[model samples]
Target: MTYTAPITEQTFVLETVAGIGEIQQLPAYESATPDLVQAILVEAGKLASGVFAPLNRKGDTEGAKWNDGAVTLPAGFADAYRQYVEGGWGSLGADPVYGGQGMPFVLASAVQEQLTSANMAFSLCMMLTQGAIEALGAHASEDQKQEYLTKLISGEWTGTMNLTEPQAGSDVGALRSRAEPHADGSYRITGQKIFITWGEHDVADNIIHLVLARLPDAPGGTKGISLFIVPKILPDGSRNDLRCVSIEHKLGIHASPTCTMSYGDEGNCIGYLVGAENAGMRAMFTMMNHARINVGMQGVSVAERAYQHALAFSKERVQVKRIIEHPDVRRMLMTMKSTTEAIRALGYLNAAAVDRAHGESDTEAKREWQALADLLTPVTKGYATDMGVEMSSLAVQVFGGMGFIEETGAAQHLRDSRIAPIYEGTNGIQALDLVNRKLPQGRWKPLFADIRETIRALPGDGDLGAIKPYLDDGLAALENATVWLVGNHGDGFDDAAAGATPYLRMFGIVAGGWLLAKQALAASERLAAGEGDPAFLKAKIVTARFFAEQIVPQGTALLGPITRGGALLFALDEAQFAA
Candidate 1:
């Protein structure tokens, strides 16, 4: 119930570890000067703390209601959404030519973390809309853009991504959704799509759904899928045949409607193609790649929210003279805080990489920036979401009996965080992507070089005197793992696959340590110069030390699992598990 945007910490990460200043130098982001960015963060913080934070508990309690194929969001949600639009928050990172502020994605990401921390369920609509904007901007035809982009950007309408069905969850190639060509050049769509977030809601006049279905003569796999723009309101202002057949009673994100949409129930539902035929997966993935980072931010958000909740609770709920004074509770709080900050920096770093990729004009620089961004994406999503769950659970522990109850709201954060790792390509899939897709993308060497350089840049004999060795060990472990994985990639494919999850976790741990160390070095420099806020700077050093000591060591321990083949995991027969 208590939350304040960590604007100062976020700003620190952006300017320091994430290279925001360099990003600002880019021509495309010249408009986002330091003062303007600070002002935006200040205003965004006010809205997040004032408008959205108050509604979070209420939304979770009241939730979105489904009746007669329509969803009614809890009271004040529509008003908050309107304010969100009027304030131009929704269009910050969208293209300027299309009714947006055209801010850099890194800056937008900072604001997004604040929103998600304040009210995650409410933020989901905005996140999905951002994805829709990206997909439409990238692939939608000019006519489609003219018809939909501005309205969606302005928040007069919203969007949904429909990819899942009863039979097809992760296996998109198995989908049975069919799209038949119409005389008017549109396609008649018929299928049931489930777990569509913000799929059906009344906050906006229309919902533009980016759907995936197959043509009758298309191939029999993911290769044949085609993307469609199916709207709730037809171009003629008539109602489309698509309807929300039902809304899932979910474990969390209670206020965000997850609909099971039935398209063309009467065989009159029309859809416009987004990209070329048999290219639906590519288009959908464009939106998905955008969503994955935001989803990772969601993890950071909930963890942040939970940490604040626990810190407040620990300070107030006195046991043996303030629970935070207890060693074990202190340890838990430090773990939560340090991990959250580390991942926050990682997320910002990822965002900054993405920004550089977009804004950089040089061909080679752009490719390198994009590679860094791609490399961090899976780690950011997988590790941060996993940390979110861990931090949220730690919050419950801090609250003791109170956290278990819904009234305390700690449990809600855990429940909400649980879905993040499962969705946006489950963490397991993220690991596989890290090893199979990202590692082979040929960025690991440069990425590892960057990591080592960061560690090497730290003051070896200064205020962080004792922590340097652990960070070194962590970096060494990561390098060894990377070498093993890459060396054995072809011949030891099964071993690499089995160790993929831990390997990614180790990647995050080392990356996080490097950033935290960078932050610590900055803090120490400020302290030595007798500049900036001494108390905050000192705390940064301590947090970094805590991470170095407590967290970095885990990276080395994962080597055992990394080299172990999947034989043990797969040795038993499917039916033998019950025995």
Candidate 2:
């Protein structure tokens, strides 16, 4: 099935739920006019559907090949990447001082949704590079920025994050990589890094790796860790002391090479420190935070692709006058459609918060926006990814035996979606971060208040009135859960931790319901004014009502889990698990 970009739906979300008008009002983004945003979305849609989507099946089928430490992508992959570079797609929200287009990130996010929907694996390279650019922009030295940021922003070179090792996994502090000081003020990084995405690829001129290692005299654990810039090719055009030892044969995203890299094998891996010594985690979080949001978008992306694939199949497959005619099939389709839309709304809303956090000049306002962004980051990443997995599975079920087969391409979406929740920190980690770290900051107070205020302000008539009771119920459940988490967090940490996942799900469900309600209200006003397409607007209202009625109730259901504490979870011992 050919991928089609949902430009109209994306535009509606941006204009209605994401507050793009407020983003455009910011001084830095004054040039991001509605017309320009629309044009960019249109062009991005073409590239995503035309160039990228066609290669997705081929990439999955052929995968990437490795030979003697060299990696090669499937046919058309490199050419498609080259087209992506020539189109300046990577520079949309990049720094204008470094030859970027300097548009708002929300627009870039919409573009990313389309690209990811088209080809999840191929889009990863760009996503990682964008993260690297942000990290370097925040912490890299002037010389380092000049050497790296320009090329990265231009898409002339791609980037990778090397934190996981054979043993380190998610415990970054456990990494054994060593960095030795050199007479030239650079360092020699020596270690083996594993699970590095796009770490070794022939599609770009060079691969810039952001590696985390430790110094000999530094303290133990994470406090001693430092980040380094280790490139495949040095400035003088000589090969750096790094090589892709091997590429992983994985369950999904086969097109994206996950590499085992050996650095300083020849004892000459020249590297420059980012930020300060032993401050690697601080700098790396910059990249990780950026990546986490995009990973969430990946969840939305795969879900959309799976939904489209299943919807198309339902229309054509004739099992008693087309499966689309069946009520059960229609229910599944509606579930996929409403959930995907909810996730997309959450992702875009999060991106807008990022834009506001950065663009706001007032100190207090910036802090509030930043806090909101922090609170939503894990929810966006965790909830969306979990739902991505669920939606893909539903899509597979929709296709029955064909979904399990390779030719139908329905399974690919399922396979490709399985990684989002695992990477950029696991969904479990996101939950812990939410309840343990973010909730304690008390930022949720204003945010929760705003949700209540927004719900209260919404019109209580017709479709809006139908959704209000569900919204109120969901919000009440979310508030009670939040109180339970906070109260238990200090005296009963394990209790709070156990309930984190459920609490996060509740937050996402309620937040998503709120945004969709807002969208429905906007669509209603537009319909009354004859300002937009009636069919689309009415559909928006219906989707909102569906989500509120069907999905929002789950928030209330999760209240039990969110308040249940760790007694049952830890009651079973290690042997009991096996038993």
Error of 2 at 468 (Å): 0.8
Which one wins on lDDT?
Answer: 2
Question: Could you give candidate 1's per-residue lDDT for residues 1-579 as a string of tens digits?
Answer: 968999889888988887888988999999999999999999999999999999998988888999999899988999999999899998899888889888989889999999999999999999999999999999999899989998999988899899998899988899999999998899999999999999999888999999999999999989999999999998899999999988888889898888999999999999999979999999999899889999999989999999999999999988859898999999999999999999999999998899999999999999999999999999999999999999999999999999999988989999888889998789999999999888877897887787777767776575577677888888788888888888778988888889999999999998898898889989888888998889999999999999999999998789888877788999999999999
Evaluate all candidate structures by whole-model CA lDDT and list the values in order: 0.91, 0.92
Q: In angstroms, how far off is 212's CA in candidate 1?
A: 0.5
Count clashing residue pairs in model 2: 0
Cα RMSDs of all predictions? Answer: 1.1, 1.0
Evaluate model 2: give its TM-score: 0.99
Candidate 2 lDDT over 1-579, as tens digits, reads: 699999999999998878999999999899899999999999999999999999999999999899999999998999999999999999999999887888988899889989999999999999999999999999999989999999999999999999999889888899999999999899999999999999998899999999999999989889999999998999999999999999999999999999999999999998889999999999999999999999999989999999999999999988868999998888899999989999999999889999999898999999988898898899999999999999999999899898999999999999999999999999999999999999999999998887888689777788888999999999999989998999998989999999998899999999989888888888989999989899999998899899999999988799998888899997888999998
